[model samples]
Target chain A: MTNIITICRKELKSYFSSPIAYLLMAMFAFLFGFFFWNAVGYFVSMSFQAQMSGRTIPMDVNEMIIRPLLMNVSVIGLFLIPLIAMRLFAEEKRSGTIELLLTSPIHDMEIIVGKWLAATILYACLLGISALNILFLFAYGQPDWKPLLIGYLGLILQAGGLLAIGAFISTTTKNQIIAGAVTFGACLMLWVLEWVAGYETATWATVLSYMSVVRHFEPFSKGVIDTRDLVYFASVIFLGLFLTARSLESLRWRS
Target chain B: MIKVEGLTKRYDRTVAVNNISFEVEKGQIVGFLGPNGAGKTTTMRILTCFLPPSEGTASVAGFDVLQSPMDVKRHIGYLPENPPVYPEMEVEEYLTFVGRLKGIPKADLALRVREASEKCAVAEVSKKLISKLSKGYRQRVGLAQAIIHNPDVLILDEPTAGLDPKQIHETRDLIRSLAGAHTIILSTHILPEVEQTCDHVVIISKGRMVAKDSVQNLTSRLRGQEAVAVEVTGGDNAAIQQRLEQVAGVSRVVARDTRDGRHSYEVESLPGCNVRGDVARAVVESGWNLHELRAVALSLEDVFLELTGAGQAAEGEKQ
Candidate 1:
């Protein structure tokens, strides 16, 4: 446990000490704000049109503005998650500090979990920007607090799954650029896999569609909780981290 | 403190270190002498638990490197050819991180870092960024990292590879001071460095053990014969050379350089012979000037070359 914290602390320090963390946070904040502005503009203009049409209908602030806005935030995360995890193991290997870590008296799991935890925290910090924008809604109007919290929860879980995958990819190479580009490609594939279900209803198609991370995330955006979605995210996290541990073990032989 | 037996590491079809075995006793500083790509670094990696041997076993501090690597790692410290330092980190911060990772207690972390930095001569640059420091300083910082935990064994690969003469001297002093508290195995191609620092020497060539013995013993073991050189002037060079070769128990005499009034000759005597007195008496009695006469013992450089066989032909020509 102490080894985990030690590695985690050092990983976090390296992240913040370089320009990578600040640059990632700033870029994420700008893009998320732009998406939030577009979502709110469309919602406000539609509300005004309804007022002029003499139709007494209600609009859900959560569904109209926050859901799509959070969805856009998850999209932005797909791009930035690669950046968060690319340097975790890749940079260490390039600089030869992997020798130090491997020779130290720490278990391989401790190092992997420590690095994954640090990446998850950085992803959460990026998600915090969307929460700041959500706080603006709470200040002006009545948005149901439970659904917003659940929406944020779903976003974090999705980030955890993708970031774990990125961490695993980072271990396979010593070049951060290759690690980042490959992780982005993998995450994008996971997002578009739900399209398989649109045209076919076969068992393989259904299974592949259910494997889509985006499919699992859709229920969370609708402010609905499901056991299957939780299980999906948990399994992805476990598998990604398990593969990372295996890659680290195989390194001794390959090198 | 360390033992390796029948260790072999093969990468694909290339065998890196092949069937080599040696042991290091406690409280001794052994030097690993080898040419480039001689598998010295590969051997050290196996001992440090960074790589596993393909065919045999290695143990450090009573733990097998393959079966109980964590226990071996806890007791061993290593410095590879390149110093493994993070450029973005401060020296003190890096040492503290290594200390914590090596399982140092929270209460003792600070003291261990301080002791390590001072011992390695990196105390003054503790707060400086590593990338800004020069290569020599970076090497010293790497040394500091290895000694931070005060492990039972230290495996250093080319520890003084990039240092200036003064830093090399200080590092040698520090390494000597570290003996008895820590058993050290440092590899270097510098022969004189080994002669100066190592109590025992292990020579490897092309992944095989060529020679392993004490520095004094290895040098004396060359040819098992005593050598003497004599300088005589104001005499016929050929006649003096032939006369010296006739001395009792003298095997051969090779003429060396000659100046205006002095000529040097290298004379080799048979095993268990003392012909220095006989050679000196012959030169004086022949009415020629006897300038200098002394026995010449082989240096570590000659022993290393002759043992490794990398430059054996050239060494033979020189002799």
Candidate 2:
């Protein structure tokens, strides 16, 4: 456990020190902030101007404020997580530093988890930086903190699933470019599975949608912590990590 | 202590290492000799537990490599042909990381890193990033990392593969300093390095172990004839040569003219025949002054060529 934490600390330090990590953070924040304003502007145009009002439209600041913030974080995270996780194993393998790690007393599982935890913490910190927007929303109106908390939880769950997939892709090759591309491709395919469900037949669509990470994220983003959704994300993370461990174990024999 | 029995590794259809068996007792510096692609690296990798052998078994310090890989890893320090190093890391940081990975106690990690840095002569570059260091310094750092754990066996594949003459001498001296305490198996293509450093030489060719024995015995066996070169005066060259050839146990003789018109005869006797007395008597009876006569022994280079079938005629002529 100490070894894991030590490796994790060093990895996190590396992420902070490299310009790539900082550049990704800046881009994510800018895009997320821009989308949040657009979402709020749309809600305002819908509520005012005496458009069509038969039902009581709850276009409160909470919907205009919290939902957009959560939605922005999730969407921006789709691009940001893979960039940080791309070098987890790919760089090490390319430089032959994997031999050092593999020959260590620590198990392969520890190395995968250490690098994943590093990326996860960096993602959380970037998300935390956007909390200033949430604080401003709190000053204007009574927004339920539950949705914000659930929104953050949803982002964590989604990012955990993406990170697992990213970790596995990093193990498939020593080229960071290929690792990044494959990870983005995997994440994008999974994200589009919900949309694909609309065209496919009912049973096939349901099964695909169940596997879709964004579908499982919906319950968490709506201020409801469904145990089923949490389990789904956890399972995805575990399965990816397990595959990564197996791949690492078998690389010597295959090579 | 190291023991290998029928160990082999094949990559697809190519046999990188055939069934080769050898042993190293505690405190012996053995040289792994072979040309490129001769399975020296493959055999070392198997001994270090970096790769699984396709067949047979090897044990280091009584730990079976196949059955107890972790134990084998803990007991061996392996330096591959190319030093596997992280260029971005500072020397001390990299050594500390390796020390920790090798399961050195935390309390002693700093001390071990310091000792290793000093021993490998990388103490001055301990704080410098490895990328900034020269190749020789980087190789030294590699050696430091390999020895940081103080494993029972050290398997170095071409430790002096690329270096200047001075650096090679320095590296050889360092390896010699670690002789008694570390059971080292170093591989090299340089023949003289084996004669100079190793007590025993294991020559591999085409993925098979061709010869394994002490350097002295190998040379003696290859020295098939008891050769004696004699420079004599006051003799007809043909008569002296013929008389020497007719001597008992003398298989052949060749005569040559020295610069001062003195005749030199090279006498080749049958194996195990000490005909130095007969050759001297024959030369004297032919009314020639026996200026010099001694048994000429074979050099290690001769043995290497004969055993590996390289430049054999050239070695014979040099005699």
Return the TM-scores of chain A for each candidate in numbered order: 0.98, 0.92
Q: Write the per-residue lDDT of candidate 2 for residues A106-136, one digit (tens) a residue.
A: 6778888888888788888888777876676
Pairs in clash, predicted candidate 1: none
Over B138-189, each residue of candidate 1 has an lDDT whose tens digit, in order, gives 9989989998999999988999998999889988998899999999999999
lDDT of 2 by residue, B209-319 (tens): 989998778777856667888888887777777788889998888765565868787788898788999888887877779999977766776666676776666647866
DockQ by candidate, in order: 0.69, 0.31
Query: Given candidate 1, what's the lDDT at residue B276?
Result: 86
Q: Who wins the TM-score comparison?
A: 1
lDDT of 1 at B221: 73
Number of colliding residue pairs in each model: 0, 0
Q: What is the C-alpha RMSD of each candidate to the true structure, in Å?
A: 3.8, 5.7
